[model samples]
Target: MKNISRSTALFERAKQFIPGGVNSPVRAFKAVGGNPLFIKKAKGAYLYDEDGNEYVDLINSWGPMILGHAYPAVEEAVREALSCSPSFGAPTAREVEMAELICSMIPSVEKVRMVNSGTEATMSAIRVARGFTGRDKIIKMEGCYHGHGDSFLISAGSGALTFGYPDSPGVTKGTALDTLTVPFNDLNAVELLVEKNAGQIAALILEPVVGNMGCVPPAEGYLEGLRKICSKSGIVLIFDEVMTGFRLSQGGAQQLYNVKPDLTTLGKIIGGGLPVGAYGGKREIMDSVSPAGPIYQAGTLSGNPMAMAAGLAMLKHLKDNPGIYDALNGTANFIIQGLQKQISKYRLSCSINHVGSMFTLFFTDKKVIDFASAKTSDTVLFGKYFQAMLSRGVYLAPSQYEALFLSAAIDKTIADRIIQASNESLEEITK
Candidate 1:
């Protein structure tokens, strides 16, 4: 077995100080039945753990690191920005340039507001939607995670689902009541909800291409249908692209799917692995934000220079080289195809849902188009498979519910390595 002595010791010590021995619930490896590997550093497509073991990184910082960890351009940008300062807590030319770039890239975003994280972006977007529309309730998809925000905790996914608490305890009943949920890709359910709560719902928010519940893509006309429903009902349409933005394409899922949302909440690749987020959309809706209008949202480090520098470099690179998306998609297809061969060979009851570079290998044969279908996966078997993969130097997301992300750094050789590991892992787990 590979040595994980340092990681095990660190986790034991961490439990005394950190909640559940991790800053994030999923990082504790509770779902996968092993101690988490504490990463010492990552470069390219590999992670070096504190135990000095090496792993082929498949999560890519949970969707950032699209160009891979410590990319030279992003590193240089941060280094240059660090020479000036980290945070000014005031206006900077970088923020303006960032906003302009976002607006130019995302046709729907005429203006944008910077924030510190995806949660902050989603929370602020919903507030702006509510204020602009003069309504109380909002609609979210079941198992679609917006963040840790109170309203978003109801029927959330990701870490919340891994912990078996979709509706978190700390969230108030009022917040729960205001957040209506519908199954993803079910236009009929959404239509019924809109009809039943006509004029009460202010916004309808979802991931255009969901990454939370294992990379489920929208059904035919699903996005267009939702767009029509919201436009007809006068409810704001918000696309939470925290995981898909830039990683899927230069302009995000919206651009890839040919659909536009009134408001878009972006993080992950937007920050280039840094703590940053942004919410932007229609000029009229964005104008409702403070200093220009009434709805109030502020962050002291909204546009941290370090984050802005890193993000700007990353975005510019993506924008200039549009072929990155094609390369990413091709690489992902190759890996998924290889895994499928192994699954068929082993006769494992498994299915993989994929879009662009994000994918999930579910331990169920049932189609994973939504939360309910995603849950049909056998968690116990997945745990075994996960450990098997880890032992072979491949690292994946620790939960059956989370998607695995691939980076540009994963070349054909790395793809072959992952495929070989998956084959061996499947054989071992089956035995």
Candidate 2:
């Protein structure tokens, strides 16, 4: 067994200052039933914990470190930028360059605004949509997480087309009243809601390919259906591509699927592992934000030079070398196939959902299309599997609800190791 004395000590010390001894709730390991390991550093698909245990990272900072952790190019760029000071809180040439690159790469984004987090990007995009459409209500799919925004912390109430109820304590009924939800991949339900609400809906937003509810991909004609519905209803179509952006494809799912959104909210890979986000779309709609028009969203550190440099380096590498996507997807397939063999070998009641490098191994025999079906997974079994994998030196997402992110750094050798470890893990768990 790996020693965790330092990690345990740090956790005990951290809890006194930070809530649950971690910044993110999932990192607490309440779901997996263990004290979370304190990571000392990470580099290229590996996490070194304070306890001296090295883990093969499968989450990749929840889908950011696409090329790999501490990529040399990004590292050097950040270092050079830091020499110019950390935060200017003022416009820099890098921000303009970053904006230009994003607008050039993403088909839907004619104009863009930088923010600090995915939450800010999504919330701002919705606000822009509302402003553009002169409407108050918005529609989001069930089980899709856009972040912890007030309007996003919602759950489906009893009836179809009924306004969502606040899923958290702090969100008010008034905020929830303007937000509506229906099952993901259910086109008829969205159509029904649109018909019921009629002309009142400002936007229809979704994760084009969901990563939040365990990497659920859109059903056949699902994204196309949403685009048609929104176009017909004059509602802004916002693709919250925070997870899928850059990870799924160069232009994200929109480009891969040949569908264009009115707005796209981006984070994760865009910052090259730093805290950054962006929302962009059509010219007329984007022009409505800030000095260009009425809708107001500002940030002190929206275009920090350090973040821009890192993002630029990462994006440039991606744009210059398109083969990275194929490599990432190929590596993911290798790992998934290995896991598949183990499942068949053990005759396990499990199914895996995957899209490119993002995937989830659900401990259920049933297919997962939406949040409700995803919930059918046996959390107890998943917790067991997670612990089993962790003990074998592979680090997975703590919760079954989240997806496992594979980076480009997970090469053939690493993939083989993951496969071997998984096979042994399955044997141990089944025994």
CA-lDDT, candidates in order: 0.93, 0.89
TM-score on alpha carbons, each prediction: 0.99, 0.97
Tens digit per residue, CA lDDT, model 2, 1-431: 67889988999999999987998777888777889999999999899999779999999999989988999999999999999999999999999999999988997899999999999999999999999999999999888888888888875211111112328778888989999999999999999999999999999999999887788999999999999999999999999999999888999999989999999999988899999999999999999998999999999999989989999999999999999999989998888998998899999999999999999998998899997888788888888888989998999988888889999898899999999989888898899
Candidate 2 off by > 4 Å: 156-166
Candidate 2, residue 83: how far the Cα is off, in Å? 0.3
Best by TM-score: 1
Clash counts per candidate, in order, are 0, 0
Over 361-383, each residue of candidate 1 has an lDDT whose tens digit, in order, gives 99998999999998899999999
Worst 10 residues of 2 by lDDT: 157-166
TM-score, candidate number 2: 0.97
Model 1 scores worst on lDDT over the 10 consecutive residues at 244-253
